[model samples]
Target: MTESDGDQPTRQRWILIRRSISGPDEITYYLACAPLDATVTDMVHIAGSRWKIEECFQSAKNECGLDQYEVRRYVGCYRHIILLFMLVQAFLAVMAV
Candidate 1:
């Protein structure tokens, strides 16, 4: 970071990958960030698996109301999470029969 960089806000560096071989008209780009010491292969793996992680989180939230919490206390929050997980499991079990 430079002197004028305002406190080095980044802990990782971002890189962009453009599919140049696909030609400009058919081009696609993927942007991702990784630690400064991370290898290209490690970054590639992280970028590749990112979609699957996101998909699982989205499915959990939508089907299980995982993001519907409104509790403030720590214990309340834990209880909500535990019950919600159990409810989701029960739903999956019922559907399997």
Candidate 2:
């Protein structure tokens, strides 16, 4: 679709729906922006990965206190995340032994 200025075309958006097999009334919807040639499977894969990423973040928050602090600067935030992940990695490595 054209922008309000009518000078450029806007990127296309697609909405995908997932329904639970056991509960037909339960539904999940995802809004996505992808290339014109992207397939349904591609979109599904990309959307499915979001859950894993979210789970990782939640795990970090719960297990490593990832969200326990606040930083006002980019460098501070970066350092915090690096340290947090290092702690997580060390913990995982010890658990693997």
Candidate 3:
């Protein structure tokens, strides 16, 4: 693709779709197109992966007292995050049974 500053049509993006599988007999979707050059399918897949991370952040903020960490140092932040990850893993493990 040529980078033309004065081109509007060349700046457009297209969307395409495809089927995604989650589990047995379970099918989902993905999208793809060309223009902006990123496929919608890939975008959906990326977003789906990130959604779990977003949920983890929300859970940490809401339930793990993550905001209570007052120290601005990198060590403090890392310590807090490690502790929270351990706590979340334990919580999920317990819920699995």
Candidate 4:
């Protein structure tokens, strides 16, 4: 598929739909590539795998001070994230001991 960008037709992303077995709601997804071996179920499964990582991020923000920043500068934000992640790692290490 192509998208009109000025005078050229650029590559356009296409979406796939997956419906729940028990609910009327559906999930729409897009892939960077269409692998020959992957089916719709595989695509959905792959997409759903990110939820675990997302939940982990949420847990860090909620419990480990991952997002507890009040800085406005870009460098300050970066520093906050780096420092907070290090602090979280230390906390986890102490917990494991």
lDDT of 2 by residue, 9-43 (tens): 44456798988799999999998876656778999
Where is model 3 more than 4 Å wrong at Cα?
1-38, 79-83, 92-97
For residues 1-97, could you state the per-residue lDDT of candidate 3 as single tens digits? Answer: 3334475544333333434555455554433334555555657667578658777766776666666657678997687775766588569757868
Model 3 deviation from native, Cα RMSD in Å: 8.6
TM-score of 4: 0.48
Could you tell me how far off, in angstroms, the CA of residue 64 lies in candidate 3 after the best superposition?
1.5
Show the lowest summed lDDT stretch of 10 residues, model 2. 1-10
The TM-score obtained by model 1 is 0.44
Report clashes for each candidate as comma-separated counts: 0, 0, 3, 0
Candidate 1: RMSD to truth: 6.8
| Alpha-carbon TM-score of each model against the true structure | 0.44, 0.64, 0.42, 0.48
Model 1 poorest ten-residue lDDT run? 1-10
Best by TM-score: 2
Question: Tens digit of lDDT per residue, candidate 1, span 24-80?
Answer: 666545655555566778877777787686776576677777678666788986767
The candidate that achieves the highest lDDT relative to the unseen native structure: 2
Model 2 Cα displacement at 80 (Å)? 5.5
Query: Which candidate model has the greater lDDT, 1 or 2?
Result: 2
